[model samples]
Target: MMENHKIAEEVIDAVGGRENIQSVAHCATRLRIMVNDKEKINQEHVEQINKVKGAFFNSGQYQIIFGTGTVNRIYEEIANLGLATMTASDQKKEAVKSGSKIQRAVRTFGDVFVPIIPVLVATGLFMGLRGLVMQDQVLALFGMKTDDVSKNFILFTQVLTDTAFIFLPALVAWSTFRVFGGTPIIGLILGLMLVSPSLPNVWSVAGGDVKPLHFFGFIPVVGYQASVLPAFIAGIIGAKLERAIRKRIPESLDLILTPFLTLLSMIILSLLVIGPAFHTVEKGILTAATTVLSLPFGIAGIILGGLNQVIVVTGVHHIFNMLEIQLLAQYHSNPYNAIVTCAGAAQGGATLAVALKTKSKKLKALSFPSALSAFLGITEPALFGVNLRYGKPFIMALIGGACGGFVASLLKLKATGMALTVIPGTLLYLNGQVLLYILVNLIAIAVAFVLTWMFGYSDKIKEEVEK
Candidate 1:
């Protein structure tokens, strides 16, 4: 308790004392402070503080990383110091007012997607596990052929692997409406309308197994299974429409009228305008992504893998979420996942090297845990806390990412999932590609570790944050 209090007091002083703090909050791993004056905060002094792992100014907040459990304790001490504490959501509402337009826009996408990641991760694992057991090699051990599997068991497996994706639009719309301040239930109903069983299945229509239902002799309609962008746009529009309608209706008529009008209007707009228009746009984006990944000689891998972490530094990495959804929707496989996993693994590698070489016990303490987090598919601790703090290690990691990307591309590796990387991400490759997945990650770690150890880091620069 004393240590936490001391750490909180030091943090308050480092960020120009409590008077400079307009508001403060803590997320899972960082202390987020919105301050009266950014210029007054000593970033280096904050990073150098005993329990502090790293500090950076981002999205209008001076964020100091302190790992997970420690942050909640530190936050309590900060509150005890008479500086008011805000909930994470309340802090975000205030912070949004100060962020640039681009940052705010990207942050919105992150807000919409963050809640949906766990569902996707679980579904991916289900798909991988099913594939593993269904594989000929694995089944051979049980003296079973593919045909020997019971039809009922196969149907049950499909239910686990396919349910989330089939109703993905509902999830997207529900979250978007919640974010945009409308009734989430309305958004969910609207999403269901898009994939109503009465309409032709999208994949079936695409494969020419059936024709789409025609409206007004021109527009075609089909179920929007496995779609993302159209549902996302529809959700935003629906939320806004519901809010607008609520204001115009009488208080007595409000509940019934608002939802009825919103749904009626949104269904028309989604089917006649948003769905058809944005799905085309979404396809174009998917095509571009596919083209890049298909580039000869693994050129695409080299470029995206090397610069991805740099993108992380700019704090716009969430943009990839949409592209990833589109890939999984269209192809049921996400090469982007494999590519980004390499980038994440490389960062872990660089951080590990720093931990082993740094004589500073403080630096060593910070680096080891940060590296472990990176290996577990969260790279912010390793990136902001260690590798980026030392300039050469980040660069070395980028090189390692590029090498791993090349290997992944050469093998044409794709995961059965998205939103996971490094260690936990092995679930996505459990089919028949587990060995290849391990191989690429190992190569990434080895390259980054070797390069960082040999030339990128030394004890001399242990206390300094790279400029």
Candidate 2:
């Protein structure tokens, strides 16, 4: 571990050191770095390192992809060096004064959410699997349902999955605080205020004619529970407040009083301004989505289906998960969920196709189980080992997914509940057009199989078999 840390430091220096970085962030398995000057960075040297899996440049960011479990530690090391700080010029990266509205919006969204992908995917999978087990009687029978097995098994799983989202503000607060070189505990306090039961409800606080109750007739914040932007704003405020308090208070009582006053002031401010502002933003986003869906479903299906794989590759697909869950909370069912179900099935079909088409005994053996796993919505093996290796499988999966998504949208199929296991969860989206979605997926796999057999097979197998 120590040696790895040293190597990470060296790699950072080789890439151009902390001073060269304008901003930095990490996703599931990649570090996204924006530099003051791209010409100064040595891309080839970074890619040649044994620890680095791949490197690419896209959208003006240099992305360094690492193998599983490696990028996180390197990210931490980079954070420790205070590399995330952006100057006035760096902030211009998303300037409304310069870029078009669409460009600015895209850059802003990517900057805010890309770093949070790993946590989202890990927790999403946990929640999805937990839902599947609890909802399925057969699976629950395998000691998962017994109270005697673990007194709080259900609660444990619920908290594990739900807490990250329920307390998302706090997570963001802590992450952003650390990025700014402030005490993380300050952010935690701000996060707690958002989700606290004691806080006034959104309707009561915002609607009532009361002058918006205050702590000291000064701090103008409201609540924080389950809030996102509020916590982020609070963290920023807390960092500055902490610095001020640290200077004023005596060195002896500094530790105790600084935190107390910082927490109190920041919490109040967050409730007053940040919480309400972001709440409005959230409402506006939902409203916009509803209006968009009211348009022709065929157009919506094509756009969503085509971009689905692209989103997944960039690790922003969790944004869709957030959208789905928020909609489910509001309306109890969402058509977008059906889109994901079909996408998973498409991946499974492609894997099956590759398995059937491959002539190499090793490749065939690898694909067989991977295809089965993909059917269950576990696509990592299929994606990393088969689809990505051969390339054709991924395209086939996308084509099939678009077909299934188009049919699903046309039929108005919606998921009744969420499930991680694709095959078992297909029932959630079942309707009059179930057969069409299935047929489309199978057709996609068949097409992929024929393509792979014709193009990907080795001459050695053909020659020997012919003889």
Q: Candidate 2: misplaced stretches above 4 Å?
A: 1-185, 195-199, 203-226, 236-251, 316-325, 328-334, 378-380, 411-421, 424-467
Clash statistics: count for each candidate: 0, 9
TM-score versus the correct structure, for each prediction? 0.97, 0.55
For model 1, the stretches where C-alpha displacement exceeds 4 angstroms are 463-467
Q: Model 2 scores what on Cα lDDT?
A: 0.61
Candidate 2 accuracy as TM-score: 0.55
Model 1, 1-467: lDDT tens digits are 89888899999999999889998899999999999999999988898788788889998889999988999999999998999889998888788777779999998889898888888888888889998999999999999999999999999998997888889899999999999999999999999988888889999999999999888988988889989989999999999999999989999999888999999999999998899998898888899999999998988778888888999999999889888877876787988888778999999999999999888788889999999989998888999998887889999999999999888888899999899899999999998999999999999899999999999999777645434
RMSD each, Å? 1.5, 9.8
Candidate 1, residue 72: lDDT: 94
lDDT scores for all predictions? 0.90, 0.61
